[model samples]
Target: MLLLALLMGGLQEAGARPNPQALSARIEVREHTARAILFELRVRNDSGHRLTLALGGRPAYNVLVKRPDGTLIWEWQRGQIVQQILEYRSLDPGEELHFEATWKLVDARGRRVPAGEYLVHGVLNLEPPETLVTDSLRVRVAPAKRRRSAK
Candidate 1:
């Protein structure tokens, strides 16, 4: 998993090059149930100065799913409704913010996606300086079990 994370440019070990944004971000597949997959996105302010994020009334972050072949399956932002006002929040050093969502094993068209390995990506989009922080994880969806008929 660590190797795959490295290949996907997701995980960063300690003492690596300091992030220009001074933030740490990561995406994880929290659980996989029969009906849906749960995901968590986290961002932490690691710098000494307070960080202000302007999300522009949309979500502070976005979640995306892609097939193993690199085909996009779903994106959280595509169906979201937001007002046209700027939203801002300040994060003190060592403070963290999180976003969680469940995917119902459906594609962008609302059709059931096939059982397979998919890549989940999270992106923290911030304005003013216009920076983006990203992380990714892989998850597998098992085939649904068949139900037995009444004897």
Candidate 2:
């Protein structure tokens, strides 16, 4: 089990230094079962002022799973159809947002993936057409167990 934490500076102006008092993000990936995995993303507003995120629609954040060689396996928003309407989310000081999703150890096509080590990370959707990416975490998936047949 590996947990990755990332500190992101607040929205900065062109040629301006990053704001230390900005939102921070953390991600964690763990095995929920031999055939499933759990992904979590936590975002906190640590600054004194309220933080606002300009999102496109549902799912303000996304989780990505890929192999060590950078082969894309699964994504949290693969088949999700969200409204194109723009939405703004605000977080007060000391406020946090938590998001979780479960993957059945399957690929985007709903096929079972082989048991092995996979790299995973989280992406935060923001305005200005920029995204915040967290560090990658390595998680292991166990092999599936075969069921016995009754004679």
Candidate 3:
């Protein structure tokens, strides 16, 4: 009975949280401008032996921007045709990989976001059941400026 309970709880908990330490990875989101934001995802091989990472599909990672209320506003993979081919890459001990994407303060439908606070994060699409994600970042978008009319 105890083992059954542990298995049920542990499996659900493991998949619900970001496991950056599992791959010695770090993610950062920063405001490049009031109308743009940047995402940086870094992964390092801290193990002694070469670490092999299986890429689940094309564009192995993604960036997400959402409202403070958890409403998704932008997704890096939206409308992208990601190939469903598996690929592998090896990282030597102490080596690292970096991935980046920028959001232009727009929603999935390509409209400017209103001036407000938003949350952003990065997701690494590894093998099945082993996805990695970065903690959500809080960002603010400034109001758009009006265009000047020519005299």
Candidate 4:
């Protein structure tokens, strides 16, 4: 009976969440009591061998947090990416590392975000030979419900 119950629970849980591998990468979101949203990035190293979060295209792509329309929100310097390469090369089999990229609840133009849904994504871009990896996430912010006016 216990085995059957465990199996049922596992099936239910599997259907409850999205497949982590279906996307290019994964991030864990945490909402703090103060309402700050944390975006934690994690990449998969399936082979557990030396890996590269390589970039491709002209201008020798660097890591970036971009708006949904492809506007640059933030760009990491070449030196920074090189430092990451030095830090994360040759991932151990079955080992994963996490990084954090935080965004205030405003657009790149410094305008307040409306109560709606927006996408958060990462882009690794550069000149030819480097591969481009893009991963996106959906974020939603809603205003607290207002109290009804008493007649």
| C-alpha lDDT score of every prediction, in listed order | 0.67, 0.71, 0.70, 0.42
Candidate 2 C-alpha error for residue 140, in Å: 0.7
The number of clashing residue pairs in model 4 is: 8
Ranking by lDDT: 2, 3, 1, 4
Clashing pairs in 2: none
lDDT of 4 by residue, 1-151 (tens): 0000000012223223322232234545655222345666554444424333322333332344455676655443432434222111334535554556555555556555556555555443322222334455666766634679999
What is the full ranking by TM-score, best candidate first? 2, 3, 1, 4
In candidate 1, which residue ranges exceed 4 Å CA deviation? 1-21, 128-133
Better of 2 and 3 by TM-score: 2
After superposition, the stretches of candidate 4 with alpha carbons farther than 4 Å from their true spots are 1-24, 32-35, 48-88, 124-134, 144-151
- In model 2, which range of ten residues has the least summed lDDT? 1-10
Question: Which candidate should be chosen as best, given lDDT against the real structure?
Answer: 2
How would you encode candidate 3's per-residue C-alpha lDDT over 22-121 as one tens digit per residue?
Answer: 3565667643776677878777765555656665688888888999999998999898999987666777767877888999989999999999898887
Q: Residue 106 of model 2: what lDDT?
A: 91
Model 2 scores a TM of 0.79
Give me candidate 3's TM-score against the actual structure.
0.77
- Candidate 2 residue-wise lDDT, 1-151, digit = tens: 1221223332342224445547677778644778787888777777777755555456667889999999989998889985555556677888877888787889999999988999888877655355667678788888889899899
**lDDT tens digits, residues 1-151, model 1?**
1101110112232223334546677888788798898888877776677655455445666788999887889988787875555556677878877888788888999987888889888866554234344655888888877899899
